[model samples]
Target: MLEVGQSTWRHLTLAQRARLLGRLHATVSASAEEWADIAATSKELEPGHPLRGEEWLGGPYAVLTALEAYRTSVRALAQGESPLARVRTDAAPGGRLCARVFPLTAIDGLLLSGYSGEVWFEPGVTEAEARRNAGLGQLTPTTPAGVGVVLGAGNVSAIPVLDVLYELMASNRVVLLKVNPTQDALLPVFERALAPLIEPGFVRIVRGAGDVGAYLTTHRSISHVHITGATPTFDAIVWGPGANGERRRRANRPLLKKPITAELGGVSPIIIVPGEWSTADLRFHAEHVVTMRLQNSGHNCIAGQIVLLSADWPQREAFLDALRVAYEAAPRRSAWYPRSDEKLQGAASDYPDASWCADGTRALIEIGAGDDATALETTEYFAPILGVVSLPGTGQEFLDAAVAHANEKLTGTLGANLLIDPAAEAALGDGFERAIADLHYGAIAINSWTAFGFLIPTLTWGGFPGSTLQNVVSGMGVVHNALLLDRVERSLTRGPFRPLPRSVSALAGPGRFSVLPKPSWFVTSRTGATVSEGFTRFRMDGNWARLMGTLVQAFRA
Candidate 1:
């Protein structure tokens, strides 16, 4: 790692930087082939059979999504219209966080509210005094381009490349990206896929461990630092470590302090309101919980950490049983990461009541408790363990109790979810609105998996105030959708109630069995392709003739 004294900023020439920037732009804009190769490589790194985790990361669906986003972005730029482009749900592009505004908004009678804080994209809208201290413009070199270093996350394959794209496209910065040790094997694939950028010096992949990361983070020549990982890692770089790290924090207080943005993890919670539901609803909700738990073996920060169920409501126990059955049936996942078993065991020790599915090879955990919102309920356990907590009372009472429970006990303020039915929402309209307002987290997703908001290019994902230049839980600020330049405390979201019953955490029953089948629907199938293509065509060409074309594609898939 290069110390402050050893770092050099003026080591590179102006002409070299310009050439590098040009190459990066051209390479990313070239063709869809590079993206396809990267996606395929990502599939190979799934730690297991391609069917389990590979399909989602770099599968056809993901490729299609990225390609569509790229097409839309270029088209919008060409038209000179800042129209929002629709990024298909399956394949999520990376650079959206650097855009002027989130392109995709709620359609289909569903509306998602952008954060209400004063918009900061334009000049002067920011508080003048605070703006002066932020040193925002200092990070943006007027010389057209400069060196950017990306500290990529190991768990996710696409993050490093995506971070590079965001910096290059959004900030007009050339980049030297460092792959985390965990992702070193995939380094060659990235280099090959991003050859155009690499050849031109616009982008280069340097592989190493923590030492390499520290070097890039503090390199004087590196103008910006974008990381997708632990908040502690980000903090250690910018502000040092521990409470005594105040010296570094103070030093960074008034200066540009290097433009650093991060997307950190959090203990995401799901609030299930009291509702009348059929057996299918129960099964579907159970499966939804299973999906969130089993996805990536629950390594995601947005993984459903806590389930706020209605304690007094009879459906709570039933839902638990359904979830248990679904989880037990889940295919055994390889113990991919270090300390995964230890972490799960630690959680089991803390919440002994929690259930575990260990058949010698793999472990799956579930928490079964009633109306207990303690530290165990709020903490983010990085293993496949789900805490089952409940709140007593009717729908309205449960809503109130649940919200209160989340705000008080949730470890990270990064995000939260509220699952409610249409009738309950209508009945408790004002109350529901008030509850949403009271939520202290950054992103609040309604009637859908919190991960959806993370996937959308239109949404900003992060945490609230307690996370500082030091300790960050929900991460320092938003990194996914770079719409706002200011600090965002929260993101409020709402979606269709039963769009996919099997994916809803509030339901308990046979619907739970359908979650696995849904993946085949999402990947390696024409269904997602047809529907996504139809939506894109309808939005672009506005052709009714293609509507049937879309449905037929889905049906055949």
Candidate 2:
């Protein structure tokens, strides 16, 4: 779709460049004011309001907060001021460490810290050189006014927005971001927050279903495409074969010649070793494994599908049973999107006796099978279905079997998770760490869910492209934490041996009622607003009393 003709890549004069940069900044800043107004209006049309459900709320504070944080961080780096030393350089292969800050909870306010070294992968750079490279991120790249089309996914609220941010901020490309019909309502929020870009022909939005997406992807004026959706969707765009659409598929090559980057779904796995676990530890991890299966009603790309069990160990049965019980008690969320129940039922029919968390409205079907372990573990169902598989030993045999099973069976190379106890780690030593390296995945999580890796701003997210483009799951390139240059396909993961009692993380068990709403309220609403505001103010004003107040409120939460 991108036609790089002779007229492309025009350069602006120095004066013109200065004017454009100032205008861009001013435009984005003024747009924030519009977003604030939208937020105020949306607040008035609350739950009891007639238009509440019909009109999606435009609470642009989150977007505004993100913009402010980005501006602050970039400005600071440009001015040679970094607090956390996240940017560092040395005379090694991966010499510089570059940290990118992405605030997950903007309800509190977005704050950027870190990014302290040479972000580039310079081979023989000193610490001073590394710092200088990081400072370059502060310098804004200029755009030549070409249209970039974005094929957005419906799952994450931030993916599309951030994709646009990447093209705009990093690539300096003008964008036309198309929203998935499933999340059509969020378009208004984007319009409000990115008003300046929208007004200046720098950004635009086109909303519809598959047809709209197809058009945009193949559009003549579109220079580039970025997608956050299913692998099937990407295939359709590049190769084309949906609903008897054979013309493009037969072509064998892509119709649109423009470069495309996609972050597709994956069938993520989580392996559990049955080594030295008390009943409590077993239960805690059981919940952890299942929580990954249940997050976002089990529609997530990184949700755990294959449960790698230590076959020879006795604790495997106990953990499985605990997981079943947890599922029985866990709330059955509304499938959330269409065709969810059909997929759930299809998965259940294969193994009828699989455990189900049902409450008339919805159900999470758990598939347990000892025979044909590989068969059930191959695909991502995009619904709440867990396939249990077992390996037959501990130590080297256990690790070997788990890794072998995953490699032999799983349909994805995007990500994997391993829950290893400290004692197990000590026993295996180098073998354990080597197994982690050997686990063929783009991202791996040790002792926790793999989703955290994607959520954390410090880590990169993407999978190997493999031989052909069609088979790739997670995707070829990485986006988050762009400061790192020579990243070996990111392993953004987290783990904590001892459990935190009140974390809303997937591992914790909250009986009958969900703790997330409470936690969200604690962080987002007026009760927490004062403290949050105080913390932000402290960065600029530095009042000790205000700082204490902020700390006290955070502690209470």
Candidate 3:
């Protein structure tokens, strides 16, 4: 299959490739409900369960958004223009070029008003360098280079699909995808959605356990590999397993000769800067934090595992109390991932003083200064075990401390988030941007969750550059960057503090305000499922009526 694809793939024109993607977009949209159903069934989310929204927004809707981004980019290339041709660029704090990704279309401005995001290039990448180097492979697609293998992720349905699209569109390679065993039930839906590529022999989907993966990885035709699983799996494939693996690692001898990339889970952090807040502010952010930690039953690789707070802040206790309320408020879902139930029990047994939900599905441990946070900082617990640490200082001092701690203490550099009040943020001024520049993370968010980097197609998703094979912090390389940017340093996003209605307060001026409602992706949303369904349909056809219906659901949520 690889040999045949390479033979015919390069012969097809850019317009032909774009049309193939267009066909894939339609079929995937048609199968969106079945894909969501597969995900819902995985976690035992029965019909009419409010958490069904998790399947739609996080599962199918996310893939739909990626398809739209990639389709647009490919179409642009077919029209003799680079994907970055219409993009606006500016200088960050260090003169490194910043690509303005959000609000690329008029609809973006209306849908996510008051939101701003940018991708900061590596140091010394001037604007010209950035533009000229953008869309490296596709800008000069002379041939379909080779075959790549994608080891799909079990936790998220979109990971494998997006990876396949990246290999085909960005790298100009055909793909042979192997779905994780945990998500094998969704194989039929994936096959149906990807029929366009499958029929043309441009893409193929296979299923199996460890042996199947080992077979494909060692195949003579496979030129590159990518995985969205655990770090141990990467090490096992790169080096031999068990004692021999450690020996090979110590001697700098790897078993695999080909290049591989990954997006492994990490102990992500959420820093809450000290500031004055109204009652509504605490409640809103409390639920926001809950969504960050418990979304998809905390199976997300970018889930918020640790939260940093200021010990001297007057509202620390109040916000913590609010968080407790929010945690207990969310309904329980089954732990379908391997050993998730045992992991949840482990959290309760490990931390005696930890508070838990009624069903023990969520655990919160409070760690004061000098308390041991070894497990929280170094380990990526698959269960919903949240750790709260109180650092010293306030204002810019606290911000600096939080950045230093997250960079120096946390195990992985995949993602980190900061939540600061609008007024308090204005007070920080230059110190705030400086702190963001200093954080050693692939993706950073302000007043938002880092998972946004995963959903946004233009933003590069990976860990901070510098991790080696021996100590793979958050794995290596990147995907889902539809812009095909090179020398990407990190993705930075800032959003409105509150949702609509309350967001109309005096603080929400034109310069900095978002009219977005409580997003349907929020687990606590009342109409999340309905809103996500509407958004999925809207993405399918871009119909005005469908969008109005989705807006109604969002407002209700």
Best by lDDT: 3
For candidate 1, write residues 1-557 as lDDT tens digits.
Answer: 22121122223332343344344334433423334344335434333342333324322223223334433443443343232332221111121112223335333211122111111221222333222222121223243546778888776565677666566545556778898776676666677657756654667788988878877777778877888877667777777656645666666552236877777777777888887766766766676666666666676777777887887877777877887777777655654655677876677666555555746432333434442446456556766777766567977788888888788777777778776766678788678877776777776777556665555543455666566555556665465443313443454445445433334542452111111123222223325433543444444334667755764554453
* Candidate achieving higher TM-score, 1 or 2: 2
**TM of each candidate vs. truth:** 0.71, 0.72, 0.97
Stretches of model 3 off by over 4 angstroms after superposition = 506-511
Pairs that collide in candidate 2 are 86-116, 87-116, 87-117, 88-117, 118-130, 311-391
Q: Per-residue lDDT for 391-435 in model 2, tens only? A: 678887889788887766787777788887666777887787667
What lDDT is obtained when candidate 2 is compared to the true structure? 0.55
Tell how far residue 123 is off in model 1, in angstroms. 17
Candidate 2 lands at a TM-score of 0.72
Worst 10 residues of 1 by lDDT: 89-98
lDDT for each of the candidates?
A: 0.55, 0.55, 0.84
lDDT of 3 by residue, 39-84 (tens): 8888888999998877777677777777777778878877877778
Total backbone clashes of model 3? 1
Give the poorly placed runs of model 2, Cα more than 4 Å off.
1-73, 76-85, 88-140, 143-145, 242-251, 360-370, 373-375, 465-467, 482-488, 501-557
